[model samples]
Target: MSPKNYEIIEHSRGWNGYFKLDVYRLRHDTFEGGKSAILDREVLERGHAVAVLPYDPVRDEVVLIEQFRPGAISVQKTYPDMPLWLNEIVAGIIEDGEKPQDVAHRETLEESGCTIIGDLEYISRYYVTPGCSSETVTLYYGRVDSTNIGGIHGVVDEGEDIRVYKVSAEECFAMLQNGQLCNATATIAVQWLMLNRDRIRKETSALRP
Candidate 1:
């Protein structure tokens, strides 16, 4: 295996709004044991985010939310089959001095009207597109009672029009297979839950009220 190495030479900030953009100039060691010329790369600086899959041990269901995404709209221009309304787990940007699990709990309530009880089990952390964006998401699975979790939720001031849905684990998998839940965070969380759901349920069973 080849050694991985890179040195950042410059990071010039461009835009600063909902998300920031920066241009980098740097170089790295080539596979041939040589240094390549300095290269300029533009990166979207979307800070770290947190996502959680709210699961009900008793009902064996997961809570998901549907909302419009402008990013999906841009993709739809090139791929018409892509959906503008995305189905995703509860997610939000992590604020300074806040832990990922805290964001998961807060977002769950604001986005799905569901309360995440018990300790949140960390699933994984991943970058959305390291090649062009500096966005990484920490994913988790939190215990919740999904029996009556379906409803319209989300903070109105933030322009969030989220519709919550509580579906069985099987249904969530089906949605993923059929392209309904194609977002990265939700897809990863659902797949992880599918693999460890039984153990998660058993461990959290005592914590549920």
Candidate 2:
């Protein structure tokens, strides 16, 4: 249903930073065929982002990066053993007038030093948190050669301290299974590759350089 279906009683704005928050007061249709009472909701207005998983089908290897995330520390505060640094796929925000594919390629190079070998195979586009966030992420699987794709790489000005890892696809799957790949994007990417590895290998074998 269109958002027009809701009666916008009021709209307000909140924090503005890397993301903005908006407050909405509205009411919508009900299953009983009557409009409900006004309800207020606060939503984090995070812009869309793109994440790409680099895989070398022939070598059976994958490129991943590890970086510290302060958000994780804030959320999982009770667990003292919780790892603040997370292993994740290459990802970046879509800059003004930039496409998802462009960000994917740029992030892959900056984070892991692996250039995307061919056209990206789209995996999924999804909301990271719909309950109170407007952030949506687009995912892709990019073919890459995993040879010598390990080191520290990232934009110094961005304060990004990234460590790249080139691991066998089987080992990556194991990480996913063992909770090492706890981030949402990495988990989803690894799961999709696990199910489609053979077909992907066959389809991209000839495309390898």
Candidate 3:
């Protein structure tokens, strides 16, 4: 699929902030024929990140986080009922030379004060918004002990004020069906958990730590 059938007619920098936006005047291979017209498109270089859903199979619970997302507020006019503070799985951006697994564990502890132990199960790697943003999330499922897992945790310097909580796996599935887990990352992770919960619970190695 990596064919040299596309041309970058021209590209210019648009924004050089937290997210770098670039305007591209390019043509790419078309499904029906040769190439598309040199149409202009703006792409945001948001970089890649990692996510992890920490589960306590013994307790049948999953750790979750709540935070205010300015991006959601920015789109409030279009979706007037959109919420500002959203509940989601723990996640963070991957720095240069950092592995996705490492970032997953790091974010879990940073956001929820829970350390992921035992075998880490990989869930998925996907683009959050491929149409306009170059952001992708590598998702995982990690084992944890939720005996005393509850807090509001996050790096103060990062301006991240995160509230952490745990819920029964059954309740999480219900939330998924009712659109409570609205974010793509949380939705995907919970849906996967719904299908694989039994197997995960049966894994003695996964219920420890």
Candidate 3, residue 195: how far the Cα is off, in Å: 0.5
lDDT per residue, candidate 2, 29-139, as tens digits? 776677888999999998899999999998999999999998887767787666899999899988889999999999999999999986999999999999999989999
Which digits, one per residue and each the tens of the lDDT, describe model 1 over residues 80-188? Answer: 9998899999999999999888898899899999888768888899989999998999988888888777879999999999999888999999999998988888889
Cα RMSD of all models vs. native, in order, equals 1.7, 1.9, 2.1
Estimate the TM-score of every prediction: 0.93, 0.94, 0.93
TM-score of 2: 0.94
Quality of model 2 by C-alpha lDDT: 0.91
The residue pairs that clash in candidate 2, if any, are none
How do the residues 16-115 of candidate 3 rate in per-residue lDDT, one tens digit apiece? 9988999999998887778888889999998899999999888899999999999897789898777889989999999999989889888989999999
lDDT of candidate model 3 versus the reference: 0.89
After superposing candidate 3, which stretches have Cα over 4 Å from the reference? 1-4, 205-209
Candidate 3 TM-score to native:
0.93
Q: Give the worst 10-residue stretch by lDDT in candidate 2.
A: 1-10
- Candidate of highest lDDT: 2
List of clashing residue pairs for candidate 3: none
Arranged by lDDT with the best first, the candidates are 2, 3, 1
